[model samples]
Target: MSEEGLEYLFKVMVVGHSNAGKTSIIQRYTKDNFSADYKTTIGVDFFMKKIIWNEDADILLQLWDLGGQDRFTNLSRAYYQQAVGAIVVFDCTSEASLLHSKEWKADIDAKVTWNGKKIPTVLFANKIDLGAGSFMKDREIIEECCRECGFIGWFETSAKDNKGIDGGMMFLISKIMELGGHAAQGEAAPTNDSTITIRPRPKKVEADNKPCC
Candidate 1:
């Protein structure tokens, strides 16, 4: 229930390379719990959370967790439909995962739009609790990558520790509200868009790589 009788619902997608802790972030955020066990997402999963923004508007965020496995990549674009914002996640300990983050961002950019505008996007460098063994350790490189991918901002987070999760989400939501104001003015993008094309990344030659954070 909102005091001003205004309710806003936003569809937000969480995407990244395989095992970048997309599901874990959502679990920690929506349920405040984390699990050590690993389970690969099949295609896509949905979760919902509500927040009161600026103490007046009620925000319902529909989080779509898209599967990161290469086989499932062909199905990702459909999940991206109608997304007003996105959080592109990557593991802090793996440089490969960080590099793959751009692919995820490109996928999103190719599919999602609000009122003829690109959706707001943020980057999450997850698993910061692992304490800096990442290949791209330099902040300059990370900032350069974010800039190249057109990310509004980036956050270092640990879903297992619940560090920076809430703040990051709030920041993303604020930006979405600010930049995607037209989404609130009318119904969001349709669930199905004929123009969207599912573009999967090229198959990697290596297998048996360790899962990302």
Candidate 2:
């Protein structure tokens, strides 16, 4: 068992097609709040949260939200560096967004690595609250995608309603902890040396009705 206050820090990145609720997931997990009027993420934003696992270990999760715009994709490689796990989100209402999930997975597989191995990843089907009108209705399709894309697991999430959010995060973190080297009972987890400051992205006057992916 870990000591009373020892903490393990892990960097987890959230990537997906634009406006697929990646930022909202981070916000819901970190702040326990959600807004319907969030703007498109411009570059990258991050927040930190602590979780106690198995009543012993402390996990400091640094959640990184990557901007989903095409222009920002060039910067993804930099953000992906040293990431321990990832959540690839897609809009359930948009087929394009779901298709683009493969692209995002490819991008992650190409860049982020730990000890020359692919980082752990989970696929999130966001916007499930929209209900019954989603483009991809079949679970088999998503399963096939996960199999081909190398995801450890997948979740049907509604960040707007906070459904499946915590469970998905906990599942991913468990996988990360298993794959990542564990610290000794009284040892300290490595610290993140780089300082990160999140800058607000400009909000658009009108929301885009078209699917962003």
Candidate 3:
């Protein structure tokens, strides 16, 4: 909570089945680099990306990448306590992963809330590059599931190719900013690093993309 600029902090949880590309999405978005052999997150792993949403505010995005294994469910709950937003991902090529997307959302809905209501969640269908053909055929079903599961929106993503990574994250951050604004509500919570500045992000020419913060 710096007085010089409107620095806001938002905690967004990333949850899904193991190997569903949850960690890969975070890696791609935060580091702009992809690794094909990333180990599954143990219990939970964290990353931070600072974006200047607009000239009016700078957002320190605290991303929690939770382990997708059954044993970590209890541990994941502890980290979900104050999260204001969520990103539920699934492998577009895996039918079972798509079905479990709803389960992930439900799990967090019971653990946290934003302003006393359910958190704003977005869905990401990762590995879209590998399944582009089938993805289009099931587009309707995917969109329907997004609505049925209470996601504010959905996007096709490929962490390996760095496609739609920023779009989905930007969309979720936009919604969270709209819903929560910048309340000094939980400023006391310590972060791995403070004094974060909204450094410039790489050039993305897509007109649909949000301005880098």
Candidate 4:
């Protein structure tokens, strides 16, 4: 999608732990293709898509795929600039990846904002094709994490099969549009009461916290 003329333009970021399939979803969504083998995203990568809002309106979404390795964490704040929406991904099979989702969300809140407002964020539990053992076990904790981090919702996704990507993405887009995109920057951003509220995570998860090596 060329950035020529569009009714609305939004900058969105995709963030998650390394190998959690963040790039896989980007490739699947933007190019309609997926690769079994992929390189880790360095620094940042950008992609854009045009959404036909209606007959008269067109929305161009600018996507920044931020590298998720801990080494790249310091660079994330800069990459997150001007992002009005976020898609936080984690591997369904990896407990570490799932736990790190909160950290990723916290980093975003600590850094960027559009018009001094918390941007809409959603979580993606990627790689469900392999299995969802971790996801299933931590379902309650994940729901609590979503609320604590202010995520609007979370979805189980498999980029390889292209499942749940579009639906989850559009939900985020609608939220951005509801927030009035760049147009209604003057209005105060409203709280999302439907989502989970920020609170102390479950004790089990708290017990599992360990410094990364």
Candidate 5:
């Protein structure tokens, strides 16, 4: 399930509020394993995966496994500053975690000021294996927050059951490739073609125009 004739590399940041199954997704994606008793990320961790496009250039995914702790959220902004893509994760069982998605978006916005910029984000409503009720409720809350905060896209996943995890990662990485194209074309890269927009501004003159006197 790989794309043909593609050679590019990009950085992706994994971010979310604490206990949002951020680590679980990473583990499942990178190592194909999930644990019910997984430990929280202390500071920040990272993993790399090489995606081949037509077997030409290798697009390396530098996944920044960000810590969800409140103290580390502010510190993680630096990681997002230059990230080509991001995965905003959330736990399907925690309404509070879903609510905090806005705060995560705000932190990124504060670090980087660009209007209607998509920034290649994949919102993951993790732990979907728990089925409905609390899980669906959390998903609904996060979806609303994404709408208000302008997230690009989303996917529901259950890292425990390995549902939608690979697809979500590939979807995000594929978008990174698309953005790489926009960047190569010298066009204003869309924050997200579906979500963010980029428009030109009129030129301004420092001094007020005056009639010849």
Candidate 6:
């Protein structure tokens, strides 16, 4: 509530099922590197990034990475309160991960009181560098997911190649500024029409086509 709405601050949670590339997306955006052997985030880790809207004002965003393991599900609900935005990411290579996105959204929704208010949520189908044929036909699946779930923004990104990371962050920042409680009362929330073109990375073919079941 800095400067009585002169500037805005937002808490955004990056959440999804296990191994959905949530941590990798955060690391790629904040650090600009991909760790092949990265460890799963145990509890929660916080990362900060500043985004400027105009010449004089800037928005400070706190991005929270929540652990997605089954044991941590009960503990993750505490982090959802008063959250302004959420990036519900899913690995495009795993069709099941996208299905799990709906479940996670429901869990978060159950914790809140609904008065026809909408949270600025973005749905990202990550790991697109793996190619289209690798994952079950994804376009129809993801489009239906967004349409049914009322997600505000949608993007396809590859954390491995660091593509679409900046655009995704910018889209979220724009949304937070538009919806930050005050704007919601008098004005329309930001339009969820962001379009990011992802350039597929050159990936090596793997022999084992095993699903991460």
lDDT of 1 by residue, 1-213 (tens): 333345677788998988889999999999998997859887888999978675446677889988887424566666777677899899989888898999888888887776556678999999998875645567998899989989999999998999988989999988877765543555454434522221112222345677799
lDDT digits (tens) for residues 107-179 of candidate 6: 6555432233556678888888886435446467677788888787688898998888789888877766654
Which candidate leads in TM-score? 1
- Residue pair clashes in candidate 4: 147-196, 148-198
Look at candidate 1 and give me any clashing residue pairs: none
Q: Mark the regions of model 1 whose C-alpha exceeds 4 Å error after superposition.
A: 1-4, 70-72, 134-136, 182-213
Q: What's each prediction's clash count?
A: 0, 0, 1, 2, 4, 0
Sort by TM-score, best first: what order? 1, 2, 3, 4, 6, 5
Which residue pairs show collisions in model 5?
117-191, 118-191, 118-192, 119-191
| Residue 108 local lDDT, model 4 | 81
List per-prediction Cα lDDT, in the order shown: 0.79, 0.79, 0.77, 0.78, 0.69, 0.69
Residue 121, candidate 2: alpha-carbon lDDT? 94
Candidate 2 — number of clashing residue pairs?
A: 0
* RMSD of candidates 1 onward, in order: 13.1, 12.5, 9.5, 15.0, 13.3, 15.0
For residues 1-213, write the lDDT of model 5, one tens digit per residue.
223234344667788988888888888888888888988888888887766554434566778887887434466655665576778888777767777777777766655533345476778888878864454654456567667887777888998899998888888777666656655444865463224322212223345778779
Candidate 6 residue-wise lDDT at 130:
80
What's the distance in Å from true for residue 53, model 1? Answer: 1.1
Candidate 3, superposed: residue stretches over 4 Å from native: 1-3, 70-72, 132-136, 182-213
* TM-scores vs. true structure, each candidate: 0.82, 0.81, 0.81, 0.80, 0.74, 0.76
